[model samples]
Target chain A: MERKLQERKVNNIVCRCEEVTEQEIRDAIRKFNLTTVDEVKRLTRAGMGLCQGRTCGSLMEKILSEEINKKVSELLPLKKRPPVRPIKIKLLAKKERESE
Target chain B: MNKTADVTVVGGGVIGCSIAYYLAKKGADVIVVEKNKGPSFGASGTNQGACPLQLFEPPVLELARQSLKLYKNLSEEIGYDIEYDNVGALVCSVDEKQYSDMKKHVEKKKKQGINVRLIEREELLKLEPTLGENVVVGVEEWESCGVNPFKVNYGFACAARRLGARFLFSTEVGKIEKDKDKVTSVATDKGKIITNFLVNAAGAWSPQIGKMLGLVIPVKPRRGQIIVTEPTPLNKRWRCISDADYLLTTAFDLKATEVSKDKRIKLGVAGVYLQESTGNWTIGSSRDFADYNTNVTMQTIRYIAKRAIKFIPKLKDVSCIRTFAGLRPFCYVDGLPILSKVDNPQNFVIATGHAGEGITLAPITGKLISELIVENKTSLPIDAFSFSRFKNAYLQNLG
Candidate 1:
């Protein structure tokens, strides 16, 4: 069973939100010589979906570290911006009004 | 590292990458030094990618026009898909005062031979039904377009690399050594690179590079927050839409305190809606003087959301997936970029201080700076953007 798993191609989906495959992430890192998650995100749209890299960020980092032959500690995590989760514009607007 | 190059461009943002590409294309030994891990990690990667030609006047307009023309064939020239879409842009007015203001502005633009026309509410709505009922008037600039900012930055870097330009990432430029008045070498954390010419294309960090040479570059970091909405079905063709106030306020350099007591105006909240090729809408933006801070405040995000909703109305239902901020390299001295060869540092050239228009002006900035270096003269007159103009201002501010 372990040998069969090893033989299987890297076809597993890394970022479900963007439907980015593991092979796609690995290829982008190798082709672009990417060292950062942000660069990979811009090139392949792996971490730019609704989840915003929350799910696939570490998976991508692992792939990046392996491709670049660098320590996982050396690779910076994906940048986290505001709106941790998707929120309706109406919610933000309502919050502003309530504050006012 | 090459250790020696004909030219060393600091900052691997769009400006630096573009300059490197142009310089390398001219057969000059070029080296790009970036403090970040990759290209476009700065403001170049964070902008909304709107090329609004109707926003400028005179010499600056000439640069914008030239840039727009170059963008038409840039994807093929660079052999990379920059996603340059010439879909045009709409500058809509939400009030009667703004409507009258736009009418006069449109007339001036028409006289200047810009392909722009003022449209009434009916025509404006027909063009963009997503706009709210408050939209009284709009000006359609047919020449304006939007490109993928990331792709454009990467395209230039990749093309330059293909053309034999050396890019040194994760490298911070330390000291710039000079022989008399001419630049001799640049000291980076990596090593000393001996180069005859140096181009400062550091975007918001231009002032720091200027400081290294004992020069005061009047560039400050002006924070602009932006919100990105989830992909939604568009009823009509995608067009870059912006509020008239955004252009007017930026053009006039209206102080937030002077404009109104309203918090939104104080925060410099302006609506600029752009739907990327991915169908996700990138909404923005709010401007504030936040020295090198790229953090998006909850208040600013809410204010931007409110302003966007005020313009599109349907945006109220759209979910905001993310919000981010970028610091524009705001040049306080005359609000124009100082793209000039400095007299003191003879071999040193300054090609920055493009605040919000970096994306729009990247190609022209690259071409003109390359011309200044290779040909020692430009195809178009750049005397207006010289550093000598800021000598008196810098002295006065220092005193």
Candidate 2:
């Protein structure tokens, strides 16, 4: 049924890295009156996972815009940090090569 | 928004929110104006959340003690769970020279009645089994703790709201109107707020606010980078840990003798490992005068990772989830916060320049600032932290 499908969508995992559900994100937005993606990320840990919100960044912005009745262009994306992708600490800790 | 209030607090970071909450609890009308969308968008939220008591000295140690007591009951008092973890801290030393230095530091702290002791490698390894073999000794402080930085900031903002404090988020303060020697109103992009007292708790931006009043608030932005790792069971039982060099790098501003030839020391990279309640280890910290830039460099990230691996070898296998940077409001004079009431601005208060200890000192700073405003005197001796101490320095800088 369409109604059952809609219910499943609410439980859909938005951020796979953190296992954060769409409903959980909605609840946090409503509770904290969060307007920005960074604020919601800090409160619900949506984008604070191994991938660092790279996959779910756009989806979160879309959801926020729809919930707040604002256009997608009006919403700011989640703040990006370094290490665009997850990197092993051993690789990062490896000493740099010396020049001749 | 209310057109008038007894106090107008600039900046909605943890310091401002805590001051607002304390003032509101005392039934003072308060308004906090923040340019950001919410609180803790700065260093307060980005920190590793460690409150190690072994790093404090003299007057600051007294404030840290009082703040620790407040943090124990803060969650209940604010009606919010701040995720406060009182697991204590370990300041590890990797060499005999550093161990001797730590022993002297411990003796000084013990004389000050601090609950700390120097432990050999045997006991150090017993406390943190995952620590690297290079760890020589550790100074264990039983009273240190960690808290969720975001929650602590948000908790204070919410509690202040509940106590009838108004927060004007996304509002930029354009000008501060003063009548001769007293603050009259604060003009923002949204509107002007008529207020009797104004508290400049803007952290790194306190200097700009001071510039508006023709005063030099000696606060500069010191950039620090931190890395967060994926959830690992290896750090499940570990308490907050740091290298003894971290104190020299942060508190003492790297004035100590050159201990290592590693370039990481130049970047102020020190090993500080803290496992959040979520099982993810937050490793940090670096210090540099990068103005207002908060970008985490690849080289700095690599240095921090190497430093972390030097402390906890198991961390070398863990995957880094993210890396971010924050700008600490470092005070140039004596490396202490400037919490005081200014005579020039009569009703203006300066509560900024906390450097790396903002989160650890928030509660006491708020209580003391509120006491100065409401009761006209503080419960603790704050004359040492007054603006008058920097009067000569300010005059010299002007000349």
Give me the candidate number with maximum DockQ. 2
**Residue by residue across A17-92, what tens digits does model 2's lDDT show?**
8899999999888876788999888888888888888889888998899889998889876787768778889898
**TM-score, model 1 to reference:** 0.95
User: Candidate 2 chain B: worst 10 consecutive residues by lDDT?
Assistant: B250-259
Q: Provide the lDDT at B267 for model 2.
A: 77
Poorest 10 consecutive residues by lDDT, candidate 1 chain B:
B250-259
Q: Which digits, one per residue and each the tens of the lDDT, describe model 2 over residues B166-283?
A: 9999998899998999999999999999999999999999999999998888889988899999988745344689888887554456454235456778778886789877889999
- Model 1, range A1-100, lDDT digits (tens) per residue? 8867654547688888888888888887876678998888998899889989988889888888998898889988888987888999998877745447
Query: Which clashing pairs does model 1 show?
Result: none
Chain A alone, TM-score for each of the models? 0.84, 0.87
TM-score for each of the candidates? 0.95, 0.95
DockQ of 2: 0.77
Tell me the lDDT of candidate 1.
Answer: 0.86
Model 1: which docking level applies? medium
